[model samples]
Target chain A: MTKPNEFAPAWQVAEAIRSGDVPAEDVTRAALDRIAALDPKVNAFTDVTAERALTEARQVDADRAAGKTLGPLAGVPMAAKNLFDITGISTRAGSKINRELPPAEEDGELLKRLSAAGAILLGGLNMGEYAYDFTGENDHDGACRNPHDTARMAGGSSSGSGAAVAAGLVSLALGSDTNGSIRVPSSFCGTFGLKPTYGRLTRYGTFPFCDSLDHLGPFARSVRDLALAYDVMQGPDPRDHACANRPAEPALPSLNEGISDLRIAVLGGYFSTDGMPEAAAALAPVAKALDADKTIDADGIDAGRAAAFIITNCESSRLHLPNLRARADDFDQDTRDRFLAGAMLPASWYVRALQVRHWYREMFAKLFETVDILLAPATPFPAPLIGQRTIEIRGKEMLTRPNIGLFTQPISAIGLPVCAVPVFSGEMPLGVQVIGAPWREDLCLRVAGHLEKEGVAVAQAPSGF
Target chain B: MTMSDDDFDSEAFIRTMAPSLGLSLDEERVAGVSVFLSIAKGMADILDAAPVPENSLELASVFDAGQTAQQAKAE
Candidate 1:
């Protein structure tokens, strides 16, 4: 008999439940018990939702008993970054002030979709304040500790999503990626994450960050879980105006199509791991496995990263302008200073940044003609120690927070689909970004699925989990 | 459009610009805000140096205009 292991992949858990080997309620309760015992050390969950999780799991069990069809993910446990509205709970986008607001009347669209697919909602995970941070440290809620070391950072703004999934409290979780929030945490926490093409998933019922760049996606122990979750959640909603009207093209069925005929290349210039040996080491094996020898550059990436930064600043600052005036003192100092600076940006600069974004997107469109997929380091290095301010790269000390997303910001700026896969090649697991052209998330996930099958990329649960 | 460090002062810009936007900065907050503005200025300068074609347009649409354009293009 297969015993219920919280660390098992979501697909396996679903299969176990479907086979009647384990009850959904038993699995959900085990997850709740794990979170209760481990979350104190990891700080991954902001809310537990134990009662609701048990009720939902019981329904799944009753349905199976009645010969009703079970959904693809019929009883797996999952959580969302706190930015996602959880119906009666206030959406605390990692800020203290938002906690005082009224409870959300409806759950976020993604959460509803996942629930419909029969994934039990464990609760909301912690994140960087207002999703402005790349580091997982938050002031209102304590810094989400890395499960691997516990002393290190969990990466942000989806810190809790990555940590919870990596720590095996949930088989998979939802995270928002606006400038590498999903990828950074995945890279640091050793999990597979997908940042689908911007507007591919509905962002309705989620707290606003930079509307221009925000994307919601999944972090899971395996690429199949990422695709399964993404497949079920794919569709257009009138609620999120940015959501594309295109119908959902399921990536799960085509995940094993393999990359035999597709042209793959390594992103060289801006995506280079110049001073980061850990990232270089992580990418080398994956590159060798893919037989990708061509190193290409996407020109004007500096401008792309810069434009992304400016757009993020201007848009997010404008969104929080009222808060800055009334409750500036309430925000984490790290988030507050950046917003303060963003508010001072002249209209001309914001316009110019958008113009640069257009030009940059054109550059990527041309680059994709030659290659179907691109590979780059998901983060410069593994998770830095929690609260460690600066890190030395190439003998120059740089602020650890902003630099963590150096490779990620440029790609996300143009709204490309990327799958960040954890490679456990060293003392600490590192991640490599399998990037595909706009709307080609299938290619990205397929390549990652290939890597996982080949054992070049794998998400190992943190030691002692 | 490349702003030389000699050409712009982030501290002075914040000191003057914050009030115009109805943002009040405490005396201690000015330096921290300047740090990020300076970083933004550096990035803005990079964007300025990059050569964009004359036809390269900004990526925003007025309200539902983008959605309407997409629908029209599809039809």
Candidate 2:
């Protein structure tokens, strides 16, 4: 068995299991041991599926012994943010309101696909309540801590997904992004995360926050592991109307193709503005590494964010209207209020935002015509303190929650595939958001792989876990 | 069109609308609603400034069918 401090990438673990260098049960036990030793301090998981993990691991061993074929991810331990339904587990979505709901009948589509690929579900991780907030601070469940600094926020609604992967408790974890959930946590935790284009993955069993903006993606310790998980998870689902019927693009091949001579653009104007100086500074190396030749202006990013917020609120309110009317007090105070406000949105405003969404998407298409990918900061800064409600930016105090997505919201509005590549400036972790045209996750991941190869923004697991 | 504060008691309006959409909110939820309202209202104003032509709506059909199919299976 690998020692507690010894770490192996997900691919390495899978290969070891496949070659019988280490038994699948031993790998499962090692991950369980790591979680037992570190989760108390990190607080990344809401539940640990110890019994189920062992069973799955043993199944893999049995299959291998019988000379049966195993999936690529067979025996690799991972977790999903609590928003995803695991068979027999209630998907709380990090809220107090869903505690009374019955356990799910089957695994969410994403989970089913991952399991089919041989990933062992370790347990459910924590997240922002109803995915309404950017900070991982949960009033019901204690906030998930950044592995780098326990007192700092991990960024959410995929908070625990980032925390678990970064702290080495799990090799891979799934996170849902609407706005910046997947990217933000990855940025804060110094892990690699991918937010595939909207409707790029199935949302059949995942709890909905805003149907239009929601995206499910992977968080992993390495870009390759993230690519592997994403490869297995990319496909259409009949149950999800938003899911487009498309053939999967082979992302792993593009990763090896390299990104030299690719026409990459560094997003200027809106993305470069309204963020921390460190965030802009972190992009310098990536710009130099990619030899980025153009500075593309994202003309309506601010406006896009506004429209996204409006649409998200209006749709979210519609989704929760019944609960808001009958049992409003049961919700996490922050999420409840956000939903109520969304409920109050005028129909005209929602319509206007939708109309603007069309315009914004066109604007992105025009930009992509000249560039393969656009690079910008993922979150404005590294994770702030868990309880920090306000932050000073350019001599002005801003609310942490709403402003955190200044760089993320606009890109998501157009449903572009984005890879959040973690960059380190000293001890704090920041990320560069690399965006590709719709259904161009291959291009996004390829550019991310290039960045990783050039040592621009390599993933770094949090120390002292 | 300009909407005066009097036209909607933004807080009360949101509270009433919350339950219809499967969201449950209470007194504390009022604050978040207010923030969202403020942000949404500001954004709606921006979109209204440059009204998009109806012809621009044709772009929604540009999605990748192959990618959509792969995503559906993964879902």
Q: Which digits, one per residue and each the tens of the lDDT, describe model 2 over residues A62-87?
A: 99999998899989989999999988
Candidate 2 stretches with Cα past 4 Å from truth are A1-6, A273-275, B1-32, B54-75
Distance from true position, residue A218, model 1, in Å?
0.3
Residues B1-75, model 2: lDDT tens digits = 666546746677666765655555556656666776776666777767654675654433245556554565565
TM values, all candidates: 0.97, 0.92
Against the native chain B, each candidate's TM-score is 0.70, 0.59
* Ten residues in sequence with the least summed lDDT for candidate 1 chain A: A1-10
lDDT score for candidate 2 against the true structure:
0.84
Q: Score residue A263 of candidate 1 by CA lDDT.
A: 97
**lDDT, model 1:** 0.92
True contacts recovered per prediction:
0.76, 0.62
Q: Where's the lowest-lDDT run of ten residues in candidate 2 chain A?
A: A1-10
